[model samples]
Target: MTEPAADSRTELSSLLHDLHLISSEKPLPPPPLPPITELLARLKEKLIGASSDSETSSLIGHVERLFQTADPDWLFSLTSVNEEGRQEELQAAYRSLVCALIGCADLPLCGDECSSLTPAAYQSVPIRAVPVCSALRALLGALGNWEETGLLWSVAPPVCVFAVTHFQDQVWTNPPSRAAARSLQEALLRAGGWRDSTHLLVGDGRQREEGEEGGKSRGILGGVLDVLQPQLTKDSWQRCEAVKLVFAWTLLQLARPSLSPHLPRLLPPPLLFNDHYRPENCMLGARCLHHIILNTPAADLRQFNRAEVVYEALFKHLYSTETTVIQLVLSCLLDLLLVLEKPPSSLDPSSGRRKPCRHDDLLRLVLIHMEAENKVALRRVYASVLPLLVDRMGVAVCRHLRRVERVVLGYLEVKDPPEETNRLKVLEVLQRMTRAAWPRMQRRRLHMLLRRLLQLMDDVSSDSQLDDLIRDKLMSQTTLCIKLLHDCSPGNAQTLLLQVDSSCCSPEVLGCLETVTMSTER
Candidate 1:
């Protein structure tokens, strides 16, 4: 045998002998094993030099046995001969073991710049020699036991990065490896609290440039982002679902202020996904964007027209036929609009006339769509979102009232079965619009709206398909709509209702009006 092979055999035999002694001793003072750092270093060197599958398997078997037999407390316990020296030694040993196991598992740790072997190169290693799933199982076992020693936190950041990078990746094709990775992730998170855990995952954002301290302290998130950013191109992100999912998972764990600092690194992936041709990707991207909009401060999103860029991306989705995509886009646009321009103040009617903004543009588009929309599901979605848009528009809803009137009239006339979800939402919009733009709810408009609402009550009362609960709800909402119209344009709605020909309306419809008037009196 070559000299190096002889040395490797000698080292392996010594490690096995130590493990046997440690396992056999039932007494307190077991024979001392080699320092952990030296022991794991030797093991890593042997694994790297392993020439055949049998050698690799034998080495891995020894590792699994060591983890199973060694007592964690004894392994990490400080020696009295050099307590301070031993503490540092133990920490280094812990870091070494983690790094060794992660390498043996063939998981990517750093990108090409930081590592001697890039991910692509790591992929070239023989699977039998590396045994990725087995390494991950052994690593998880070590981490699970080490967690009780409290030494796990010292080495958590790298393990966290590995977990996240490996999390749901296509490279981890083995089901057992995937499960092992997931368990390791939960173990790390439990060892580190969520905020602190995510903090480590995102890193401090102060990554040093190359050649500076060898770029050793680049934040975990920054490093991952660097690797991921290049993969977020138009053609690339579609194939990078795992990358998108990881970014979404991390972004959701953070909120405003905390999330603001990382926006530059965090924003690109979702935008690419948002612009994808697939509906599922589009929806996922929109959800990520929505979380960003809700959690980020208005001022941060407004910087450098960031809000406008997001608005344009989401605005195009308004034309999407996918209900889920449209829903997410509408929600994202609503919150984003607040960043672009403040909501029109109801306290000042003049605010409505102050130059049209994107809110008007969006509402105009929605109204045009609503005017022609034929799908019941879409009508319900539009109806449900309309009230929120009007609330955001405040008195500015008056600008779209001409179209709003058309939408309300058309939507109310349609029969939304099982539950009048669309009609109910339209009534809510009408009530809010009346309160915001009471002055516009008048003259012929008031007469037309009141007549349609009375007709609706009659229509609802006569429809046998509606249950008692739905009928009552429809009558009550119709009553509230008329009551708001009357409240907004005092005396006019009541006068119009009173002047209605008795033969034109049913007694139930008329009773609903009576109920509104009575409630108004009270």
Candidate 2:
């Protein structure tokens, strides 16, 4: 190869020199929240007024770095997806980025950039809006223009979902974040998030409804829906179960009159349902249904495209042979139980009565898991899941005490290694199960259940291969059960209390009792 002359300044040669300069900059500081507003204000100044393309471009790089700094999660995720450590960091950073982007868009910089940049840049018009308010939508409508950049267009739901979720965790108190979220939804909806299998269009890719005026969309939305509808079939973000679920979630947030028509195609279990018995399909469908159950308003459920089909899909997945799928299903079911919002009177004939809810169906579904053969079931999920059920639904779930007793008794049979861990998990669930009375159960049955609980406490075996930590956990769980019952039940708690003395209580249990008594006295 011949050496190039230095004076020519070939585009490729100049790019190489620029890369070296960028590589020499100081490492970005750890992204704390305090500096962001100021950082953005400076970024806004450079973006709006700078005539230098190079300066504008450098500031754009700062924007990306800001996202990386604000959310190490984006870096960790981009670097090592399977690593669990950065999930919290990613969530925090993501929330900050969402808020910051919205903040920047509201600045004069955004309007200036909008004008200076070619219309080609804002081609995917609506999804790229400032606040997605009626004003912005109308701005696009009046200008007859939109974004050329589909940059975040396709994956907007998952991004919107994560932002809204973190905002919810923050208690939805940030008005800018909330406005930004609504703006994003309008943008995405304009991008066509609510289509399903039945939405048809002419091959030239225009809506068949000819007379509706510019309703003859180049059908950009129809294409976006097509991409999202069987999203996973194509792989990457489109195929991700989380992305699929959040898409449904974003739609639920918008249940507007124009938007509700799009729900059937984008949601509805049957449209997305394939050979759901496959673990990947089952997990994807279960996850999507989970968010659907969560995001759909209680008032809109019945009207939201065969929601019964969705619930039935959930019911089937609860019995999934795959424990991972079942665990995921359990989480969705638990959410449904918690958020089982009833329809308002005008929306239902029940007129504020406790209309038939999927929660009742969920309770029956949980009992089926309990009723499954103990040796066949995954005790790990069962143990953790049942307690959450009883805790959330309270006495209504306690009605199934016989099922609980049967499950506990079935687990207590074997001291073998195969059964040891299962025993520990069941003991934890059982302790939580006994925190309140089963008003419907016979006192004899309660006695039997309580007796089993005591027997579990007393059956310590040093000969077992169980390590000290495992044994301690078992003992601690057993002690807490007694404490919970002691606190929550009346006569039953009193009856159980008589069974424990210095002899029955392990040192940990004794210590726990002392703490309780001391606190009570104070």
Best by TM-score: 1
Candidate 1, pairs of clashing residues: none
Tens-digit lDDT string for candidate 2 (29-81) = 31122222333344445556656645544544555433322332222222432
What's the lDDT of the predicted structure labeled candidate 2? 0.47
Task: For each candidate, give its TM-score against the true structure.
Answer: 0.72, 0.46
What lDDT, from 0 to 1, does candidate 1 have? 0.69
In candidate 1, position 82 carries an lDDT of 53
User: Lowest lDDT 10-mer window, candidate 1?
Assistant: 107-116
Residue-level error in angstroms, candidate 1, position 487: 4.1
Task: Give all candidate RMSDs, comma-separated.
Answer: 8.7, 19.7
